[model samples]
Target chain A: MKRNILLLLVIFVGIGFLLHAWPSFSQEGEEEAGYPTYPIIFTKPLKAVLFDHKVHVEKAGLSCEDCHEDIFKMEAGSTQQNEDFNMDSLYKGKYCGVCHNGEMAFASNTRCASCHIGVMGYERLLKKQHSSESSSEH
Target chain B: MFKGFADWVKSLKNEGVEHIASEERRAFLKLGLVITGVYAGGKLLSVVSRVREVYADIPEYVDKYPYKPHYSMVLRTDRCIDCQLCMEACRKTNHVPPYGWRTRILEQHLPSGEGQWTRRFMPILCNHCNEPPCVRACPTRATYKDPETGIVKVNVKKCIGCKTCMAACPYDMRYFNEEKRAIDKCDFCWESRLSKGKFPTACAKACPAGVRIFGDLADPNSRVYQLVHDPYRAIWVLRPSMGARPNVFYTIN
Candidate 1:
């Protein structure tokens, strides 16, 4: 009876530990899926724009292969270096327009604020990052 | 036998529409009354008797030009990206301190749809109102609307720094300049640029997106006049209910 009770106690403790560590374990799993867990922020050509890998990958059901090596380079923000990487280019079925052509997703011209978070958003993001960093340090 | 008519009526069950379900009541009420919502107290309910009309009429000051070169600005609100280049240019040209701002961008997250929101940046500055509340509120006559250009200006020498004008301003555009020891606000870059024969304000010139269109409102050919006068375009000023008669207008292109 004591041995059975010890086994049950061990199982209950294991379950409790798993429950406690679940969030961090899931976060690690997301990172291991080969995409950055944090939203990628672009600052070039404008103050800022936000791109979420999770939104495109999980929500929109897009794979890395869909955008990689063709529409966008494997390296992030590489498209921004090009002079043609702008709204005009997007309207002409290039870059973001490849998918965001009103059919696949919302057109680039229609919902501008969705991506263009602007200077204020950029500053807010910086503040958030700073706060998170300080908190983690503590 | 019944005692009387009053006593007989009182004896009957007091069944009114009060016991009806809210959904059934709403269905009945939907015919004439537009029920807005039930308030927290549960006693207070709001109903819109008539459909609120969208801005269908032209602005009051379409043809009226009181000042000779009535300086005005029309912001194409949708075009603004909140890059803040205009703010930087204004600061550099006008020597605005870090603590103070003659112009600033406001960020808003407007509800786009159910469980969704969209971000927008609105740039605001001194409206240079036709009937400036700040001018009327000034005890020392330090702030005045210029008769020549219609630009509201502050006379720093006359200013006692009472900040009455700051409080009176409907737009909340005025801020105290600690260095000057006076309440400072945007004069449409008149002291720095416009008086120097420069057509547009520093902020207007610096905007890469062509968001700010500054021109003489009196001139029929000017872009500002055309944009404001466009019958199809919905031109609106901030806080129109305040009736400050703001010269600055906002529109989306």
Candidate 2:
């Protein structure tokens, strides 16, 4: 009877561990399904800017059809290749300015560091990526 | 007896300012002075206080521009995008090592609303303060502020490398250069670009955003002067309470 109690305790702890790690497991599943779960960092014309698909989709309640192939192409970083991908273009109601026109969202001119993460943010992101990769290797 | 005296004073008629003529009040108001209170019972002692309009950051001494050129920089803080092109130019021009930085960008996450935060990037460099604490801390007399151009410079040969200036610096702009065997900092590109007949510093020239406006503060026509002197724009300096009297100014367009 003592041996059976020990097995039951082990099962309880195992179930607790899985419960704690359930969110990360679901995130991994999303990544595997080509959901663009990771943040897309753009580097062109300037050092960096950040775009989060999860924030747009889940938080802002935007569907894939709203932006995909209409506002932005399906492939990431492709828009940056064009010559008019700079801030002047944004002010003229192009790219991010399409929605961020002071009505739907905050104007692109204001809250600069929100989108333009700058070189420091770029370096921090690189460091995070390196650490995560090294931890995965172990 | 003192209590009886106080009671007698209280019982006396309290003559209000109705006797004072409106013309006298109007004259005082025109001179930007207000007669706040009358202390000596009558109009004999009127506390006329001057209503002086003063910007806290712009000190009275700045109007003199002690140095001839009075080299200064006005930063449009809002325009800074943190691309780090200025930093790269400074590194290339000054030969700053990978570990060391002449200028740096700091990030701040300020709360915008409920559960939301806004990011701001602040770029910092040597302010070349009028009363530099680093110059005061140096034991070897290695660093000195130039009287002609007002640029605080270092004489590397005289430097003892004691690192006291590094500790004394309010802005944390100085670093020990392993190659030079002395403390190095941003000289506003004096040694690299300015001394070579170049108009503006490398960092200022390299910035694509036109954030750093470098010019003589003494000159009325210069962009730096106009930006700082503008009444509408709010101008401020970092660590003004330190009493450094920083030449570098920050404003938003």
Candidate 3:
């Protein structure tokens, strides 16, 4: 009975360790896992803005730690919830402007069209997503 | 008879020559303009003088560019935010690979009174020099300057991927394209857009900020010409000591 209890305790300890390491693994936010795969869209300035995690993190060689829990929360679209998540804030070197102010990366004030896809592009992207989903279902 | 002919030639020269002092050229010009304005509605004279004022720095009144339309770019460095839309646009328009870039933005850390205003962005591309070192370095004559537009172009078919031109470039703008088996760099979006009768390059059009001013440097009416020729504006080129005579001009404004 003592041996069985010890085995049970070991199993519990193993599970607990796995749980502790879980957040760090997810923190990387690699697209291979397929969580947060789509572009995060912001629609405050009447024009839709797109933040592509894959492009910045993967293509541009940025780390998840570069933004997560510091500049932005790990929760997707958490930035849009903040009142200061606007162009004015960006110009002042807050949020995206932290690196994008022509220092670490491209400035937030410049390249407005690349990120600000406008309502038309947003709708087109929505249509595309819908079409792809419907096609996958078929 | 020879003396009479010589005197007649001298008199012919003197007829057109205004005896008015050279220092009073501006006054003469103003007076002539007023007379022409009164007689020929003055509109033509005013326009001509304005154009002359803009182009007074250029010595060649007839033609500054040997090429018909000399393609050039002027970058307003202060306005760049480093958003890299120009880089993305170039990649998309030129079908550039992920590893390569025809144009890139550089970040400059300027010491400021306040630390908040310390960063600046500079956009860089192929200079397309008057005396292009890449053109001289090309063994197979793959890279050559277009006489018509004065654009340095790569004849990809002839390029053996030697990377000699890449080394020759002072700005380090060229890259070896494994797919094309040639040295690839910014052709100012010539094949993708300019040949299709496009006015400005893809990068210039894509920039949200009015940073890249692309136009014919030879044309007095062009924005590039006006910006570069402006005595008031502090215009400069990268690595002037190289003596490439780069066509691309950079300024704060």
All models: lDDT? 0.83, 0.83, 0.76
**Mind giving the per-residue lDDT tens digits that candidate 2 earns over A1-138?**
999999999999998887766657747856764467767889899989999887787777888888888778889889889889988988898888888889888998887777888988888899987886665444
- For model 1, the superposed segments whose C-alpha errors exceed 4 Å read A1-29, A32-34, B1-59
Q: Candidate 2: where is the Cα deviation over 4 Å? A: A1-35, A58-61, A133-138, B1-62
Residue pairs with clashing backbones, model 2: none
Per-residue accuracy of model 1 over A1-138 as CA lDDT, tens digit each: 999999999999998887676556646855687786776788877788889888898899998889988998878777788888878888999988999999999987776678888888889899988886665444
Poorest 10 consecutive residues by lDDT, candidate 2 chain A: A26-35
Pairing residues by index, what is the TM-score of model 1? 0.77
lDDT tens string, model 1, B65-123? 89989999999888788889999999999999999999999888888799988787789
Instruction: Report per-candidate DockQ.
Output: 0.43, 0.58, 0.02
Proportion of native contacts found in each model? 0.50, 0.75, 0.00
Per-residue lDDT value at A109 in model 2 = 84
lDDT of 3 by residue, B120-169 (tens): 66889999988899999999999999989889999988999999999999
TM-score for the A-chain in each candidate structure: 0.74, 0.74, 0.70
